[model samples]
Target: MPVQVSPERFDEIVGEALDLIPEELAARMENVAVLTADAPSPTQRRGRTGRSLLGLYEGVNLTRRSPVRYSAVMPDRITIFRLSHCRIVRDEDELRRRVARTVAHEIAHHFGISDDRLRELGAY
Candidate 1:
């Protein structure tokens, strides 16, 4: 059975997962906001299996930015889908692991790491 949690508890888990990031990396993360949603919005679903989207990073990545061109932009958003995660995990422990992995994966995007590269590094 899928593990379920209150929104507050889920947010706590997300925070815990974020804390797993290395301090050096965390320090370099700028103009980014970490958020949690019960589920991805319809536009966010974007033809993918909605439940498959554990998290999303929406913004220009660091590597693609230029000091001159990158200015006056809203903060990047990294959204963790709480319900989607809850629908897939078997227990709280598994949920934590999954959330941690998803959080790392999304943060990697902020650092200009692509999913393909992450796969190459066995990060998946």
Candidate 2:
């Protein structure tokens, strides 16, 4: 069954997860915005009706950005889906763990890491 968590609590959990990232990596993140959504949008669903998307990183990745054009670009976005994450966890502790994992996974995408590579690293 899906666990119930208040919106404020869920946001708190997400914040805590972001805090867990290593300082060296976190410090290197530039022009990035980490956000939370209740759930993935229909368009974001991409026809995967039953699958849960824990998080999504949108915008150009670090490695793909041209140095000359990077200065005026908007911040990259990392959105963590609260409802989808909460639905899969058993309790607060599990939610926390999952949030941390999801945050790391999304941040990896920001750094230009592909899902295939993340899976090989056991981070997917």
Candidate 3:
């Protein structure tokens, strides 16, 4: 079973995880929003079975964008699911580790890393 944490503490953990990202990557992160949600919405869970998502990246990947037409688009979004992550960990320390991993995994998606590649690199 997972451990419980106050919402404020969870947000702090998320912030800390984000801060752990490499400086070069963080500096290059443009028009991207990092958000936290209680859980994945129904639409996000469609076609999945008994699996919970810890984080999700939604938008055009950097590698797939057209240089001429990408400027006017909305910022990409990366949502970290708080309750889902909380429900998958054993303690605060584990929760922190999980948050860091989830954040990195989603950010990789932003960099055009596919799920299969993430799995190959053991980041998934």
Q: If scored against the real structure, what TM-score would every candidate get?
A: 0.95, 0.92, 0.92
Mind giving the per-residue lDDT tens digits that candidate 2 earns over 8-113? 8988998999999999999989899999989888777786665778889988888988878777877989999989988898888999999999999999999999
Model 1 residue 63 lDDT score: 90
- Candidate 3 clash figure, as a count: 0
lDDT per residue as tens, model 1, 21-122: 999999999889999999889888887862378999999998988889789999999999998899898999999999999999999999999989999999
lDDT per model, in order? 0.93, 0.89, 0.89
Ranking by lDDT: 1, 3, 2
The lDDT of model 1 is: 0.93
Query: What total of clashing residue pairs does each candidate reach?
Result: 0, 0, 0
Candidate topping lDDT = 1
Q: Write one digit per residue (lDDT tens) for candidate 3, span 1-124.
A: 8789987898899999999999999997777899888888988777767678888898988888887969888899999999999888999999999999999999999999999999999875
